[model samples]
Target: MMNVLSAQDKQRWRQDGYLVLPGFFEQAATEEMLGRARQLLDEFDVEGHPLTTFKTEADGEHVGDDYFIGSNDKIRYFLEPSSLSKPAPGAPSKLLVPPAQSINKIGHALAQLDPVFRKYTLENEKVANVAKDLGYHQSPRVLQSMIICKQPRIGGVVPSHNDSTFLYTDPPSAVGCWIALEECTPQNGCLSFLPGSHKTARVSSRFVKDPSGRGTTFESVAGVEPNEEKWDELDGWVEAACPAGTLVLIHGNVMHRSPPNPSDKSRLIYTFHMIEGAEGYTYDEKNWLQPTKDMPFPALF
Candidate 1:
């Protein structure tokens, strides 16, 4: 494995809860991945897709339908809520544009199912090395992967929250890798993060399946209640706008968000979460996402 993170980078990660590495991936690589994503979007049939709109709200509520829950090991497409229009009362919603232009994301198992995504995810040694450098000394596994297509005019907003709230594990060890497939700008809803919030913020709420097994919802973590103060009001927030191929490493507890893209262009990004898989670190069973017995989460090494 090659050396990726330096001492300065490590320090920055500890102090800021995130690190941005410009040009971490080459232009050719990003373009190839982006092209493949576009191909997949173009080929997807939305005729009978159930029209599951992907929603993540500012209040910590998220979409927890069967489609979202069952996508742990399968690649699936989700629609943008803003792009759907109601033609009549008591009727199903219809998309305003073509399927390719209306999709909000393709997610949950791209790395495991698609060879194009796998090359940059599970097969990327530089990423694995970065995990090792970040203190995944015993074992680390890729938990979830997704391609977020911030479509022009209809892309939704993602509220401020930490990744660990969605991908919880005992002792709270999860890191996020965000790769920009296209140029990200403030006008196109680039990510904004609260620096060093990881040190003060706790994973107060968790996204988990209901005990009845019908759906999922957010549950308060034991002894950690939600803060009355809003996270967005905190100081030292910084917006990250970078060119294609930039990689951003995010600590699990860092508070971050991206505004809705209302521009003429789209901002495409690929993101995956990693968790400690070593002994003594337990993955929560009630977590909305789970690995099947037939197909477990693959380790980095």
Candidate 2:
């Protein structure tokens, strides 16, 4: 299988701070993923458990908005695990994997069955190569998952922000892989990004209201103030729309957000994050970032 990114692609990533690998997964893989998701939902329902939960108020005041089924509680949880399964000792403590075989199957399948999917992760060649190119020797770390299931009337917008601010890391080196499980279009609240924002220095953190108004606004970490008119400056900024199985890779420092799903159908997406190594970083019990590393990449990958 092809394992390396083309020089042109690398250059584009360097220049734009993001890259879109359209149709990275085949129809077969996409269908399989959907099947797995359906099975998980059924299992959760059979057990009288919720298959989807809210990751943020942006998901709206419904059970399905920003729905995430299976094991990933850090993203959202659908069911509680049975006694047959249990969480790992000192596992990230995010409740990402519920203690159930059916739910665990989803996580396991995601980690093993899909190479193209796996390649976007921190351990993947592209990430490692990027880290090395940037003078880091360690591989990036998987931060969290952002799963979305947009509702029709209630679908809410995710405001612009940088992911780096939420994560606590030094020399901030992280990226996000957003995989569309269903067709996404402007009508369905597709994601939009500001190109080259990641290459800029980190900006001050701020708080903004979540579109759904479920509660307090999500704390935004890495976006410039509106007065900066950052979006107007990026000629390459594009609204991302793609069919199922498309993957959008973005820098952690990049500014991005999505609008409400105004369409009749739901829009499903899964986003994951990776960072280069675990050293020189500190986190509180809440897993929020605290200061640690003071220097940039010191070693080559």
Candidate 3:
């Protein structure tokens, strides 16, 4: 098969732990994805769980464990405070009507649930080539698909985090393909990644299911010390200002984050995470999410 990423693209990803593939997908394809994403939001009557660290300020209470463990083959919504309108003046102030746009993200796992996503992920030759080029000589396990709409004006800041901390595999294989469906700008919000931080930084902790299965918790590693000055120490971040149809490859351990969106416009993107799924590699048992017996992670190669 032909390589999806050119030699130069691979080199860029190697040197920086990330790479930007500008205009990767066609404009029509991105438009179709954006349209499908919006349509999915209209299908669900229920709002989603804001699963961010800053979710205390979100509209709903903390997300229940069932959402993470049981939503393998379903489409759900996650809200950003910006999506919903504030209570009307002089009214009860308790019931906030669904604002102009009231869904911040569409999922934590999507390809396994939706046909459109599944078709593109499993059948698209181009996508498979990218997976092959990423050193996954065997089939790649493609999971954790989401359409994140950084809503205008009130999108919260996403703190820097490592992908492997959440999706840790035995050999530590986790890579994220963040695709911009709409223009991602510094004015709205775009990802900023620290160059070459993955080599030295360690996974300090992991978000996992509690032993008793009551709720989710972060289990900290015994000896790993938090590196507060790491981002500053490594040449700082490179903001990914990409237009629609662009793809950004993010390393599993690279430190990355995005600021709150303060602009009137919105930044919409679709993201998928892949990990080595071949034998000899095991998914961490303690990780907060797992495939229910009915739905399992799919293959792409």
Best by TM-score: 1
Best candidate per lDDT, number?
1
> Candidate 2's C-alpha lDDT?
0.52
Each model's total of backbone clashes? 0, 8, 1
Ranking by TM-score: 1, 3, 2
What does the lDDT read for residue 98 in candidate 1?
91
Q: What is the TM-score of each candidate against the true structure?
A: 0.96, 0.61, 0.86
Q: Model 2 compared with the native: what TM-score? A: 0.61
Q: In model 1, where is the ten-residue run with the lowest total lDDT?
A: 56-65
lDDT of 1 at 280: 84
Query: What's the lDDT for all of these models?
Result: 0.88, 0.52, 0.73
Comparing candidate 1 with candidate 2, which one achieves the higher lDDT?
Answer: 1
Q: Give all candidate RMSDs, comma-separated.
A: 1.3, 10.4, 4.1
lDDT of 1 at 230: 83
**Model 1, C-alpha of 22: deviation from truth (Å):** 0.6
Query: What tens digits encode model 2's per-residue C-alpha lDDT throughout 37-138?
Result: 555444443243334333333212322223331222222333222212344885422333333322312231233234444444433555455444433225
